[model samples]
Target: MNSIKQTCKNVKTLVDSFLNSTTPIFCTPTDEPKDTEAWYSTWEDNYIGDFLNNSVVKAGLKKIADFYCAKQLDVLLRHSSELKASSYPQLYRIYKECCKRLGFVKMPKLYITYQIFGINALSLEVKGHKLILLSRMATIRLNEKELRFILGHELGHHQQGNLVCHTVNGLLDTFNTSSEIFGPMISDTIEVPMKRWCRQSEFNADRAGYICCGDIDAVTNLFLKLGMESVCSAYNEYKELEDAHPHLQTRFTELKKIHKTIKVNR
Candidate 1:
């Protein structure tokens, strides 16, 4: 019994260390864009990059990304449409407007998958495939400005080095089914730190979106809508108390402050 306990403890430590190591952010092959200098502070990227690039996390992510690719593939396949200037001219127009300022060295392939329902866009980078999934509901639900926020936000992840965090998250979820006994423990140890990182990383992405759209109201409205969706009976003010994002109020306040600083500096 003691040996088993020791073994468990050792395994947990190893997993924790693996998850905490930093992975390098994804970048283009040559003449990489340094746009993050404008949108995100180096400290912000360093803080989270330190944890996301961990060898274990990166390895696990490489292994599990295929699961998500397979699971959501049918829906993705249906769309079969990649948005570009030639193909989806109108939508591509909006994407380009946001892309240039956001400083993406290369654009990720955009997949517009129509499911009967679901409102979301996703950024996934794994094994050299970078993709953005724009769902049907997102197209229907968001207006031109809101869509700009969404596009910049996704690009923000790429630009600001936040996608590895998402990749690490995918690994945890993918393994939850098979490793029930150890999964929860591994999940808890990483959650708090990851939660903290994710929330901060979100702030980075939000700021990037603001820079792209140059509209505080559009960005604030985007988060406000999500916050209202997540609201229960009470509002939590503690920054660390929330899931991978700051509360709506916190975000609204912080973003306002950031905008003010930017205006002053400019």
Candidate 2:
């Protein structure tokens, strides 16, 4: 109990120092090569490189090319509340600040929808229109830095060229509904590999989150909110084969390792 209290105290001290300091202590959008080349998870880069080249994935992409239609209108017009500087001043500031710090050439639209519980956030690029969607619970529960982490993580998908692959997964889910026709075919060619790649992609995004939030303690705290600190087992790995996101513990461990390396280098 004392250890936990001490840790929290330490984290609070670090966060206060970070916010109060004038100098930039972490990488900013100006840090050249404004893309994942700077901070991509090496394993994720290699895996995605191979995943993109696979003849099956290439063929699947061709088949699903037409499904990349923009849905920003549907989200904006029919579903969620859009965040704009004129309206949601504070939240919008955080969104824009994250975009600038993350090196996004064009700011993506941000939107939020009601959700009673649980944090939810996602980003997508459809026909060149990019947007980030978040559950209202996220804005209500997370602090500004944690929110930056979420936005940065989502934007990282675009930075790392994972959007098309993500779109493929979304389309696959839609196709799975009519599994009698598309199941065996997609399951054989694209499903598992795509899911595996998507899980790995989270590591890349976590790195982006770390860079954007500029606070490891805040990142881990966000993970705690997501219930990702539990132990992971072999069974968890097997079950995660077709999961889009990795286990919380696995993600926490991976990010911790990354944060250690980043600290040493800095």
Q: Model 2 residue 32 lDDT? A: 45
Best by TM-score: 2
Local accuracy of candidate 2 as per-residue lDDT tens digits, 19-130: 3443322424665443324355555433335646554444445334424454444644356788888878998888887777666767778778763237978776654567
List TM-scores for all candidates, in order: 0.71, 0.71
**Per-residue C-alpha lDDT of model 1 across residues 1-266, encoded as one tens digit per residue:** 46434644564466556445645445458764445344453344332345456555455455445545655655665765778778778788888877777666567778787643466788877555667788877777777878887887788777765575666565655565479696676555554556667777677776766666677777667766654443433535553463666766666666777775542211
Regions of candidate 2 where Cα sits further than 4 Å from its true position: 1-41, 44-77, 115-117, 173-185, 263-266
Q: How many steric overlaps are in each model, in order? A: 5, 0
CA error at residue 92 for candidate 1, angstroms = 0.9
